[model samples]
Target: MGTCACLRVRGGIRLSRVQHNKGERSTLMKKYLATACALCMGLGVAQASQITVINSEAASFVGVNSNESLGDPSNVVMNWTFTGGFNANNVHISGNLTEVLTGTFASEADIFATLPSGTLDIDQSSTGNYTGTVAVSTDVSIATPVDPAGNVSFEFYESFNDGAGTDQIWDDITIEFQEIGIQNGMVNLGALPSDGSLVTYSGHNVAGGLDFFDFSIGGPGVGAAGSYLNAQTIDPVTGDTIDTEIGLFDSAGVLVAFDDDGQDFALGGLYSMLSFGVDDPLTGSDTTPGADGATLAAGDYTLVVGGYDTNFEDLTIGVSTLADVIAGTSAGDYDLQLSYVPEPASLMLLGFVGMLGLRRRR
Candidate 1:
């Protein structure tokens, strides 16, 4: 009978031990759940804040050039359609520099907004890849000569390039233009801007944040006898410089490639490509800060093309106008690769729960 009583007492002690172990396991499980929630929350925030690059459409008033108005095959238009992608598909940007007369403020002003209306949009399919297109209509206009008995003529030359930046590399540079078509309204005007006449030329100047510039025009402003200059007037007419500057469509009627040391576009100079120094907001300087050079990341950007990194004193406007757009149009998109690395808290909770499981099994 005593042995039976001792066995019962021992069984009660074992039962108490098991119950105590179960309580500890429950506490460990709660901790494990909390840790998991925290980890998931952090991951969610990280993913939500990721950055992306997109394509866009934009325009600017770079400068101007004048040509004697000529008939088709000589007097020409260059409607541009820019298309391309970056390595690893990080940036997707494109647009058409077409001859559209929709002169809204943002549309006319040298601004880069978003895609469709803003210039570009990023590929949201995946944070790493992007793609899009822009259509720019480029047409030259031949003004009726002041001399009723005279004709007008003009021609265009365009080019493209990838601007400067660290994480950005532009490749597969393909510039496509629509082949001139014969319409019913086509005129065979000849011997343009007959001597003793005045023609007016105007257009926009565009550039990427990477110090790259592209020039375009609509009206063949000047006849062969005249000249033009794409310039920047910092003080506006006073022609002085301060923190503020603006582009000028110099159809001043001078045929020289440059004036007062002003830069000039070569013959067939529609797509004038050049690099310029971007003023550094941080240091208030034009030179880049690092060897790779200070670069623009994925954000809104206003890029100008005038002067050089080492030659600021000259103040030569590289192209006619400056074009601004989003950094995504150049940088592509932002994506961070992540892996599941067990956290210390998670490990501790798992360990405790595992131990409880073992205890329950026992």
Candidate 2:
């Protein structure tokens, strides 16, 4: 009887050791799982949304000198050669002239010459190089009389001749020219928005008559549907919202989506809105595959903003005001707001991680 009792006690000790070891192994497994989940949550949290704004401004000038006889019937041609490439779609050429009329004439009648006027003509080459000529001529008669001293010296005179007593005519004319060009605007989106993310950017459409914003989505999983893009005109001075239109282009320069009226019905049915990866949130409409309907993908894209109904074909010269955009006029001052929204899957993963963390704590 004593031997049997000792054997039972030894069995009990072995069973207790096995149970303790099993409990320790279970705790270690739970810890390993918890660490792996925490790592995934950390990675998700690290992936935040990003945005960028970009623009360009450039200008150049030229100078010219020429001589014209007061009685000469021919126009003065001032040639201009661009020192640098005129890469902008729209180029503005302006000039200032100083004339030194230094010739002697016989009488007041000889002083009655035509005043000088000028015009500009530009030729743009296929390579974006600009070569232009400015023509100046005296179209109308000058009414200034010769001095009693038989000498004519008039500062800031449009047309002048040496006094009638002398044989003096116009000479030594100088002209200064300035040119401005607007290259299209460009921005690159290197990082895409994750789920539950919102990105925003602000820009001005004043430099080029037409504003073209090119954005490239480079990172992975960017074009998944359920993303949103929006653009509107906010008053730079008053901070008031104005009416506008927005359009999107794919990597191949194909029109993908366009919006003239946004979902904000409270603003008299004006504003612009667009969606990615889903149907129209406001109209409950399924997006078509290409025409104003598409899922954004990781690729090059473009955004065009302008006055309502502004002809996009001639974006080289965009309209200037919301009224002009509405009327289809010129390009004007505008403050733009652009944004992006993330996909639903990204949000779901984040939520699931949060719940898991809460449950583990409990």
Report the number of the highest-TM-score candidate. Answer: 2
Model 1 regions more than 4 Å off: 1-24, 38-44, 47-362
Q: What's the C-alpha lDDT at position 308 in model 1?
A: 21
Model 1 C-alpha RMSD vs. true structure (Å) is 32.2
lDDT scores for all predictions? Answer: 0.21, 0.36
Q: For residues 1-362, write the lDDT of model 1, one tens digit per residue.
A: 01212113210100011123655766644543443333323222111111222322222222221111222232133233233221122222223232212221111211111222122211111112122322333222112111111111112221111111111111211111112211111111111121111111111111112221112222222211122212221111222221211122223311112111111122111112111112211111221212112221111112122222211122354332222211111111111110111122444567799999999999
- Model 1 residue 346 CA deviation (Å) reads 20
Q: What is the lDDT of residue 276 in candidate 1?
A: 17
Residue 31 in model 2: lDDT: 41
Native-to-model Cα distance after best TM-score fit, residue 279 in candidate 2, in Å: 7.8
For model 2, how does the per-residue alpha-carbon lDDT over 299-338 read when each residue is reduced to its tens digit?
6676676555644443444422222222232243344444
TM-score of every model versus the real structure: 0.14, 0.41
TM-score of 2: 0.41
